[model samples]
Target chain A: MSDPMAFLLWVKGPMFNWALAIFALGTLARLLEIFLLGRRPNYAEPRGGEWGPGLRTVLTRSVADPGTFQRAPFDVLVGWIWHVGFLIALLLFIPHIELIQALIGLGWPGLPNPVVDAATAVTLVALVATLIHRLRHPVKRHLSTAEDYLIWTVTFLPLITGYLAYHRLIGPYPLALGLHILAAEIFLIVLPFTKLTHIFTAFIARWYNGAIFGRKGVQS
Target chain B: MSEPSIERGLQALRAEIDAPVAAFFSSCVHCGLCAQACPFYLETGDPKYTPVLKLEPLRRVWEREFTLWGRIKAGLGLSPKVTDALLAEWEELLYDSCTMCGRCSLVCPVGNDLQYMIRKAREGMVASGHAPEGLIGAAVRAVQTGSPMGLQWKTLEVQIRHVESSTGLTVPVDVPDVEYLVLLSSMEIINFPEYLEAIARIFDHAGVGWTLSTDCFEATNAGVQIGSKDIAATLVQRIVDAAVKLRVKNVISPECGHAYTAVRWEGPNLIGRPYPFHVYHIIEVLDALRAAGRLRTEGKETDRLSLHDPCNLARKSGVIQEQRNLMDLVAENFVDLEEHGRYQWCCGAGGGVSSNERADALRRAAFKRKKAQIEAVEPERMVTMCATCRTQLEEGLEEFNMDIPVVGLTEMLAEHLVEK
Candidate 1:
């Protein structure tokens, strides 16, 4: 058999160029979304104190409620597992690492092959579990729209294709790799357009909550 | 188990909703983030009781009976059967378990309005004659009589006279040509008369010309909370008629959260035009007084206070900051609870959940989150701007045996009011 690395190089030449173009365009689109669609100041003006104090109060108290996270153990477990798993897969994927290394000249010590493989497998299972939850649960199923299914599909494709490419499970490693890269690029393009945008906004919400409660002298 | 008249009523309401309600139900993308925001979901670990899942029956009906996609799914046998038993079960889940607190909406990524949907579902139940017997009975009495408690006009008169004698401030009733007409909920007159006393003292202190109408003084419209527009309309119409009759410049809705929203947001629309008189929630009135230097308070420097934002006032009516301002003037030791303002936690008492005996367990479960929040502050007292929330929190504290004082924002202000 021909060297898989050779095929990878050939695909990389064109795929890299396509990835860069989409990355630039997608980043630009995300920025436009932040500036245009995301600029509404949903916070109300404090009727008593200035904005500064109110803002301070919101920021401080959100962190103070460490106990809410503690009390709702199942929620915290699910939330953390899903969020952290998604972030690790998204940021440390080989192609994404390559992009980061190329753009910023930074690299982390790679995880052992077995660990990487196991994490990827676990993440895929968790994603499936979450999707099933949305389907089987009557309340969640009721609230779900068609766009929700689209997000799940878009998110799932990259992880699945990337796993297939890593294991060389398909006809050729190169083809799987190219599909994986393409899926990821498409996800980036749609990230801000869908409910996935909650990733960026959740922290802002958390911190705003912390500060508001902090100023009020309540433990977040 | 089946009453023909009630079943007929429910069928008519479900039929009347038409397409828009169905469309909204069909648009839910369940990320479960709303689950995190729901107090019931947090305490019980029961996903079935989560705010998002609570809307399933409506969603199923929309899919199977209303939407084209739903019709296709039903034709294919892909949609589950929605039997009368299923409807009965959902009646318990949707009406009895959920608190329509709107917290879920704030955290919802798509902004799926669970509260609005639940309210519509309750309206449907009321039409079907499936409403909780207590709510329906109270509403019926409210419509036939003037107040939910069935307090007679003479009793209201004595309550008014009592306020005047106790506070050395005359609370005028049925006075024509008053500049402002104040409306009090029967709960305030009977359960928390200090709220009425606070209002009279504040108005007297400010020298604002205000009169309470003995005929239509109760601000609470149980219809609004229970999702009966007809009953809500009847309650609000009385206030509107009195405002117009009294020739008042403004109508002040006391520190009742749902009452304020009903009159301010729905009152004008129900009346079919903008009301001639301005409607102000008591918090707004207090903020105005503090701003204009008319209502002065010696802040409680020693006592630590935390403010619980009521859902109706904060999310529904957009009066989030007004309560905070009132808290600041009234409490020197005020600490803002986390998730304050629009993001604040529900007191687990809104949307008529406080009145449903069957829902008490779910209500108690939901209250755990708010209690945790209160304990986090470790404040000497937790102050609120809504009367129902005050009742709910106080009741919850007693039921749960938590050490926290639940007082109205008006009550707190009255304690700190500058003596003239």
Candidate 2:
């Protein structure tokens, strides 16, 4: 256990279990707390129907509208690149696909190595661009708190370390791999508790806003 | 001296934290898209005026009070406290610079309702005695008198008499079993009595049965602007009780943006029951008449025209297309503003900014966004349905030295009513 390789094994086994437990239970608890708060039912006669706009907004809000796109195209463009690149880099790799298949009995052909390597490079660039943009823009800097910068760093560690391990760009290969797994574990552990909850809540918020505004007859 | 208490303010904020609010705070991605949508931020280049930034105090309160991590942070004295000075500093951000326009809410990638929180934050402002005196006085009058401007029934009666003499039409008062109970804003009663005359002439031509209730004629709720739900509920109760007493089939909210929001949207929620009758914005009623062939206009205005959408009406209430449909009947030369309807910018006065004299400079500053939109189209006249928006546009144009004259959509429709 004193060996670095042995430490990496511990992180992959016991540490993985701990991260998964916290991620699942914490997320469920936070979601329940929000739902239990319960809104006072509105008695106003609805000016428009709800379900149509409510469900529609959950999908529609994925892309910025023309007005919003005009105001900040760079943010939107970088944002989509990061999201798509991260999903491909994380989920479509051969080892990651095998891990999922082992756990959930789901498997698919992984993208070729060169393709994932390109996505890794693009994802890393988008993530760094986001950090620079956040720090440089006055309004973004004003709205940002310690939590925001911290989230950015935590979200960055797994990808950068993974890139380093895959390309053998720096450090010992196993050490980098072990650190990447640890960084991902930390992210999973913190996901349900922090602003990173946006992964789940953003959809619900859009639905609720759409429903309320929809009932008022606005296409939110 | 009766002063607002921190306890009251904190209590109001606590009361506002429901499921949606909690979710909104958690989901906010700090994307800064809302700042781009905010006219105040665009006009002043001030980050503090960002729509989401305006909710800092409220968000602080939510974090420290609601979230586990935030509560832990608070226990360690790590979180910023919502102190008296904090409330004072935020008063302008919450009230003066914001129009509760909902553009930020609409543009948010995560769907955080920044305007909703701003409105909730004002509850804290009012409770802590941090609200601007101009708005406080208006709310006080709205409570004591039937109208916010302290206009009496006699004032309306004189205008009604003048309208009668000029138009040769009776202004029905407290008529039983009328089809519509028309609620007027004091702004309309005081600044634009011609709106009443237009309604009288249009209703005569359209043959819509309606009356003005002396008991609840003023529809704009200062309590809504001031962000006190108790006071707002009282104002809504007056309208509800009057409608029940009058037994009218419907109530008409006229030529006022927030007035319609107050009565049509918030009214039932405030009063705790649906009204026996429905409510409609005057433009919606007119459009319905237009659809039914009950309205006929002699001719279209030859001058080029465009609409300035009031935030509460077009964006918040879904009264977008109805105004455009009505405009088509009387405006042959009408051109839509490039950013018209739901995406339209505010005239920067609807959410009680007009009543708060302190906000005059900031209000005018935000109006530049609308000014640019209107300038691009180069309209001969600006037509809007909301009285508060109309007032803001007229004042904003005058300050900018722009030669455009503004007219109410109802007045324009009245001008073209087919001669009976």
lDDT of all the models against the reference? 0.68, 0.89
- Highest-scoring model, TM-score: 2
Query: Model 1 shows how many backbone clashes?
Result: 35
Please, what are the lDDT tens digits per residue for candidate 2 over residues A14-108?
99899989999889977876788888878888988778888877888888889888879998899989988888988999989998899789999
Question: Model 2 residue B218 lDDT?
Answer: 89
Candidate 2 — which residues are off by over 4 angstroms?
Answer: A105-110, B1-3
Chain A fold similarity by TM-score, each prediction: 0.70, 0.92
TM-score of chain A of 1: 0.70
Global CA lDDT computed for model 2? 0.89
**lDDT for each residue of candidate 1 in A1-220, tens digit (9 for 90 to 100):** 1665664664466656665676566545544333332221212222233245334433442231343454344444554565566667666666567777887899765556666677778878877877887788655675567778888898888888888978989757666776777677667666644445445433333333333322222222
All candidates: interface RMSD? 9.9, 0.9
Candidate 1 lDDT by residue in tens digits, B175-228: 888878988877777778788888888888887888877668878878976777
Worst 10 residues of 2 chain B by lDDT: B1-10
lDDT of 2 by residue, B158-252 (tens): 99999999999999999989999999989998889899999999999999898988888889999999898889999899999888899999999
**Clash totals in order:** 35, 0
